[model samples]
Target: MATYVLVAGAWHGSWCWVEVARMLEAAGHRVLTPNLLGTEAEDEPETTEPLHRWAEQIAEIVRQEVDEVVLVGHSRAGLVISEVAERVPEKIDLLVYLAAYLLQDGQTLNDWAQRAHNADAMTNAVAFHSDGTCTIKPEILEKIFCNRTSAHFIDFARARTVPEPIAAFMSPIQISHERFSSVRLGYIECLQDQAIPLDMQKAMQAPFPNVMTEKLDCDHSPFFSMPHELVSALERFRRAE
Candidate 1:
């Protein structure tokens, strides 16, 4: 069975992957959904640690696996998984970007977000805090992220949503061709995404070499909106590899 390391995006913890993890586990694949630093609680402010530290935390988890891992990152975590692959390239079987920001070397999430058509709307929907973190406004969570998801799932996400570290978004990732290029990459695009924008997702997938691409006709949160489809796509990608 393949080992899957699932990473959540900004303002999310391992809780966001519960359904997906369950589905994968039922299929006999080992799945890990670790909570990133500063995302364990809604009240915790963003830590001052650099992005590499967060990447190291994830790398530490992957190091425990006995076999190579299928590393999956959601939303802003596309950067985290990329850095993890750089740190532990030998441990990764494939890198999957689930509607995430697949940034290149020296690029920051802020750089790509600025080019998105809904940047203004997404920025305005956030409540910036004094502690260099921000939370999405509750009133617009359904409109922006869960527009196509069920009410129960949307409410579940809204309740668990937390403030996300801004430093991670501002920090530029450093990936080397020698280290990161060897890992197999894949991208899952959410066609109806409002937060990242469909066009920007396509742009991010443009640079990867021999990357597999799949399209989900859902909003930004496909795990909640279309868990079965997401699981099927992930299975197909793994089998194809």
Candidate 2:
């Protein structure tokens, strides 16, 4: 059985992948939902670490596994998994992006996001603060992220989201062809995702070819809206590889 590491995006924790991890475990595969450093609600004000800290955490998790791992990143986490692949390419069996920021070397997540300006829902959805942290607009949270989720889950998600550290979003990821490009990649497109639109996802992926792809007809928050379908897509990634 393959080990799966599910990394949540900003403002979220291991809680986001609850259902996905549970389903993967039931199928006899090992699953890890690792929360980034200082991302918990209580850690909001103190969350000053950059994106690479999350990458280091995932790489350590991969080292714990006896074999290669399927690294899955959601939304903003696309950046984190990419960094992890650079650190331990051999330990990673496949790098998976679920409606995430699949940026290239020297490109910051902010650089890719600005192309949309105010057209996409994600631009104004986040409010930046002087303390180098950001907060999601509660009103727009469900709209851009969980619009397709059930009413109960929408509430479930809203209450759990915490403030995010902004340094990671602005930091340029250090990767290279000799290291980062050695790992195989996969992308799971959330066609209905408003947080990161289909066009943006395609643009981020344009630089990388021969990457495995899967599609989901759901919002950005598929973990809450389409966990079964998300698991199905992940299973497809395993089979394809």
Candidate 3:
């Protein structure tokens, strides 16, 4: 059985992975849905937390695990998983990205957002603060991230969502071909994703060859809207990859 460390995206807590974790655990997988540093709703974002810190935290989680780990990241969390995989490539058996921002060595989330045609839906939703924090508008969150999701989940997600540090998006990622490329990459592309559209998802995977690809006909947040399909895809990675 693989130990899965599922990292949450920006403005989201580990709460988002509750249902998904439940399903994975039922299938005999130990899942760790760790809320990244400062992702809590009540936690005040006084100072900016950069990308490396997020990556280091995940790396530490991987280091403590004894079983082969499948490191999964969602949305903004893709950058964290990629950096951590390179940092401890030997421990991470597989890397999974769910409509995430998979950047190169010098690329930042801002760079990819600018390139994505439908990024306005996500970028426009951001409400930046003078204190160097930002959050997505609640109204826009429903349309972009939770489109077609049940009313219950929409409320659950909104209430738990918090402000994300601005520096995390602006921080340039550091990954190398020698270390990062050695590990296998799997991407679950959400075709209807308004946030990170299908085109951008394919473009991000283009740089890396033999990245096992899977598609879901749902929106950006598959774990919420189409969890069964999402878990099925994850299981496919373990068997087919």
Best candidate according to lDDT: 1
lDDT of 2 by residue, 6-68 (tens): 988877779989989899999999888867777776664544556877788778889889999
Q: How well does each candidate superpose onto the true structure, as a TM-score?
A: 0.97, 0.95, 0.97
What are the runs in model 1 whose C-alpha is more than 4 Å off?
Answer: none
Clashes of each: 0, 0, 0
lDDT of model 1, residue 105: 97
Residues 18-77 of candidate 1 have per-residue lDDT tens digits of 899999999999998888777877436545754777799999999998999999999989
| Model 3: per-residue Cα lDDT over 1-241, one tens digit each | 7788999888887998988999999999999999888777666663555588888888998999987799989999999999998799999889999999888998899898877777666678889998889988998888889886888999998888898999888888899999998888999999888888789999999988889999999987888999999999998987774
lDDT winner between candidates 1 and 3: 1
Model 1, residue 135: distance off in Å is 0.4
For model 3, the stretches where C-alpha displacement exceeds 4 angstroms are 46-49
lDDT of each: 0.89, 0.85, 0.87
Error of 3 at 179 (Å): 0.7
Compute the lDDT of residue 224 as modeled in candidate 1.
Answer: 93
- Clashes by residue pair, model 3: none
Residue 24 of model 2 has an lDDT of 92
